[model samples]
Target: MEETTMLSLLPPALALLMIIATRKVLPSLGVGIIVGALILNDWAFIPSVSLIWEAFSSIFVSEGAINDWELFIILFLLILGIMASLISFSGGSRAFGDWALQRVKTRVGSQLITLIFGILVFIDDYFNSLTVGQVSRPLTDRHNVSRAKLAYIVDSAAAPICVLAPLSSWGAYIITIIDDILSDYSGIAYSGLQAFIYMLPMNFYALAAILFVFLVIVWKLDIGSMRKHEERAIVHQQLLDPTRKNVPGDHSQDLDTHHGSVSDLVIPIVALIISTISFMIFTGARAVDNATLLTIFAETDVARSLVYGGLIGLGASVLLTLSKRPSPFQMLRATWNGIKSMLPAIYILILAWIIVTIIDQLRTGEYLAGLIDGSIPTVFLPALLFIMAGLIAFSTGTSWGTFTILLPIAGEIASVLDLSMILPFLAAVLAGSILGDHCSPISDTTILSSTGAGSHHIDHVVTQLPYAILTAIGAFIGFLVLGMTGSTLGGLLVTLLIIVGIAFSLKSVITPLPEN
Candidate 1:
């Protein structure tokens, strides 16, 4: 209530613990929100009850948290479900899978395709997760690739790629934050864009994540729970393990319903990508007059663009179906069925949003940022900031929020302690935020990726944790080296070697399951 004191941190900590214990995301989030409300209301049960109710309803209040962007995101997810359903109902997914099977014969190739798609959709993480998951799931399923692994690939591709892509939503968002931080310190005259570029090579975690995913594919490296999931899928042809209760949704929908061609799928996917890019440019241009394309991208409203893109994609799917002479009534039914299937994921997303809001109200990120705001040794600042940013992002379940909170603090700390460490510190904060967000079970992108892959949410988290930790280790060491030598190439070399070594060492412990 009064900044992020010890008591204020209790709610999120409790929430994370509950999620780990119960493996139920929604109720765990509710428990956390209630605790936060109780603390805010001075532990009065009746008042806390009312406050909890207010928390849910407040989003709907005029000009409240559920603004146009939020609504667009919600609609986009729903549309994704419908689009996925349409593809299945029209047999496009099945056709595509069949077509893929003829060309990509092995699990490795299937995964590589999924990873490539994830990398291609780099405009936004949200888009990348949904589109890649939907597009690749069928192919992966046919190849006995675990949904957990598919979700991992999708999640890795989404945010990691966006952060590295200079023209992406993540790049724009972080750049703006860095600009604000630069404004306060006259020691440097770097624009947000320039700062982002300067730190790009230093973003070891993001680079490592993308590389590690491909390495996992090429090396067939699976460890921890992920190995078990992969073994089950490949050896037993079991996609969803019966022991897991958190399956996102029923993925056994009719994928062989109609005599649809592969174009039914490809056309909609192409339309979605094209429409999204077009709308992004249009929106960005409207936001500024005579702005360069790159500047327009920096100014674009990604959520709104996604909304239009999803709608256009949906339209294209429907039209493609109609051209094949499907009944209009059948089309409506298919769309509605798809929407219904996504309700579970949507509920989890809404709950996640509410929990994030509660954490924000409690000033969790600010509290964590404040802990490391003061002076520190120059050599230790980069690594310390990375760890701190990761912790805050993990707790709050939002990398963007982590960026907004820590970028300024990192800037101030670097300026006061060692101006030369600025790039590494900023890079550490950015990379750490992505690492934490990737690993956090409550993260929205993680949830979306799980839904897209039709994997159990906790299962996805369990499987992805080890890989995320590996990347974080590389990133931490990279930051340490950067702080000491101020050499980007040296840090990059050390980080890459560490990650590659980890991969090789783990490969011996857990042999990849043989192809069936």
Candidate 2:
């Protein structure tokens, strides 16, 4: 671990393999954590057990106080779940579904609405996934869209859109890291924000992924396991796979959604969005003296703001539900069901966090970064970094972590070999991390997407892999073009052309699912 050895790769590899084989994410992560702990402790049983305990406890109790960031995130999830439940109990979801059905009128329209909503909620990926899922699920389900597909759409939008938006959590975090990287070298004319903007055009994966989502919806391009899920939805009217059990965030059969107006859902969602942005700016202002938009976003406490917004959203939901005048027993039942629905997601998140900690201790990312050597030609640097960053992120289940480890290495490599290529190299890392996060089963965004869509987690992961890979293929080609031609436009054009060709070819050959 200290020397960045290949041994660091084993645990995540084992966990991913087990997840694919068994379709049991929690147990796979638990096994990975145990194995990682054992490896870290030299295979000593007692020491490994102690390390595991410490890792688990540290999440809740850091430096003798509660870990506000981690706890607040959990709180936000619970609050959102409760709000969703109350909205359903008050008939907000059903009412909205009816309203959407009257206007939307087609599966393609419903999916497009979901995609647009996902893109608009780009302040944070977590907020985007859950909020879009909540608002779109009722509409999509009414249109006979599969939960797996909904989860895919949510997952695709979350990281890809956030990574591209300079006002988002992902952008803020990346900018801070870029600033640090810039300080290490001179003659780099661009500031962090400027560099981010320049690289936006070079972020092939993000752009390609977003475009692919639109194409998939418009072309009805359902392939792999996704086709099966879509067929089941259209033919049997089942949003989720019937064989899958213990799905997280599934309230399809648990709520009485028969008595509220469309405002019942809209008001709470609008309140949540407004309050969250307000708290983000407030908290960010307290952290910085200037209080400008960029600075505020860069310094903002995202998790804390989410918790505050969730409280307001929950309050709005409770007040609206109260107007319906449900009995005390019914209220309690709905609240319990809401809380219970989110427990599976909470459990998986904690386990994923623990395994991530173990992986960090193993120095898996550093080990991966160490693989790059000076012998490689500069023309291949962008493409290679993309693959490396993707592998690291896929293994670690964290795109930001991948960025932290690879960006510095990329900067160093570019400085030593070709300084002009710095932005392209950095852009590759960003694009790759998003690609990996989309594919990683243990990624928090991926897990939250499943929860939001009420899909079985494995189903989401399985169905999304092919789409993510296809985008990555387009991105990989784009990076190669950028490296050779030194033109962001050239790379982007080629990427789009390749994606369009592949999409149209697949559409022509594969039979579209029947309309219900």
Candidate 3:
């Protein structure tokens, strides 16, 4: 029953075609799911229809055969919506924006601060994307930063930071995958945790991404589509025209009427941050009978922690609003308004989840992995694995799924080639998956990042593409060198130098926006 034929490619190919044709995500994903269901049920009409219905229904249901992740994503996203609304209506965002403008005066400082903030929240990419986007959008906007650029920073920080942070939810899931795959292999000397650690320095895409953000911010090395967006945003700002509203995610109602203090914004954000970290630690601790900090962190339920944090943050927002003498009904109205603004994003997320389920059912990822399983030259194995993994993740729009499908294959291939090649190959898989996830328009993280930064989804993808490709180029070269030299440290140094050099060379093309 495993997917072995060319027919398995139908669903993803159709999905990609749909996305490119319509520039609309929902209908494309829906059509893809329907086709996948039909294929999965052997083209039987009634069974395929039934499968589609079940998939739709499964998005809200947490129990039973459906993955609990679906429910978690739905609830967490809704809660975040409510929280963002509450913060905005409470005048927290405006206050924070004003406060930030005073302290972070320059464009470079604003961007660097945004990047640093994004890096700090490394626990969960979902949380990182939403929180960083909502909190920093106003601040970044004050400095005339384009929503697309803000989206790029937020998106980059999400998965890339989590992948590198060993104590994050991403790291934990990777650890579990490694354990499952290596359980039967007797010759592998390193533990899953150790192997994961060994692969970290070799995660060139992540290093390139993080460093690239810094380079772009410090050197003003804006290039490609981003430069145009940046120029437009700056021009709009310089005109000081009150009628022009070029900001992307500023969908909220007028904030000029609210006379709330800066604490209104600052306090709720602090509450959300503290609550999320605390709940993560608490959940992780309880999950392990005898737990150290590492064990507790690794075992934490990411979605559940987000739920706890969202509720606490919501509570703080309510209390802060009430303290300002707002009526109870007014508070409710603000909360509802926040939820309403987030409805479009929530709808997109639900559809995305459904399509992912359908893709899983059709075994689209496995089919892609099988294509590169044993056909490549031995010397190019590491680089090839990276490229293959990137393609699978790009096509599927799911990096975690790509990791789950490709890591085991990479591990087995490395074992067959030479025991020493194991970690490098695994590292390649990790790097490639992140790169694909970072760039893919359909990626859940990418979607959420755009939602967070208030940028148009396509705008985010288009603007971020050139930077992501540059990083990928650096990573590919690094993998090639690693495969040839068989040295992790040397490969990493070379990759970092190459990316930095590429970044500097880009400076020659940097053209600042026109002055007022």
**Candidate that scores best on lDDT:** 2
- For model 3, the stretches where C-alpha displacement exceeds 4 angstroms are 42-44, 62-68, 180-183, 237-251, 327-329, 373-375, 514-516
TM values, all candidates: 0.96, 0.99, 0.92
Angstrom error at residue 101, model 1 = 0.7
Provide the RMSD of all predictions against the true structure, rounded to 1 decimal: 1.9, 0.9, 3.0
Off by over 4 Å in 1: 64-66, 187-189, 243-246, 249-251, 324-332, 373-375
Worst 10 residues of 2 by lDDT: 250-259
- Which residue pairs overlap in candidate 2's backbone? none
Native-to-model Cα distance after best TM-score fit, residue 441 in candidate 2, in Å? 1.0
Superior by TM-score: candidate 1 or candidate 2: 2
- Residue lDDT tens for model 3, 1-516: 255566766777787678766766668777777888888888898998898878788876645665566677667777777777767776777888888889988887887888999999998898899899988877887888888888998988899999988788898888778877777577777787887888899898888889887887787777876887788788766212233333223445634346667787777778888999999999899999998766777788878888888888888877877777766787677766666666667777777777777777777788778888565666688888889888878877899999989998887887777767877888889999999899776688998898888776666777888889988888889889899888888888888898899988887776655422
**CA shift at 498, candidate 2, in angstroms?**
0.7
Tens-digit lDDT track of model 2 for 1-516:
356678889999999999999999999999999999989988899999999999899889999999998788889989988889889888999999999999998999999999999999999999998889988998998999999999999988999999999998888889989988987889987899999999999999999999999999999999999999999999989888888778788776556745789999999999999999999989999999887788888999999999999999999999999998888988898888889889899999999999999999999998999989899999999999999999999999999999989999999998899998999999999999998999998899999999998888989999999999999999999999999999999999999999998899999998888667
Q: Counting only residues 3 or more apart in sequence or on different chains, how many pairs clash (N, Cα, C under 3 Å) in candidate 3?
A: 1
Give the candidate order by descending TM-score. Answer: 2, 1, 3
lDDT of each: 0.85, 0.92, 0.79
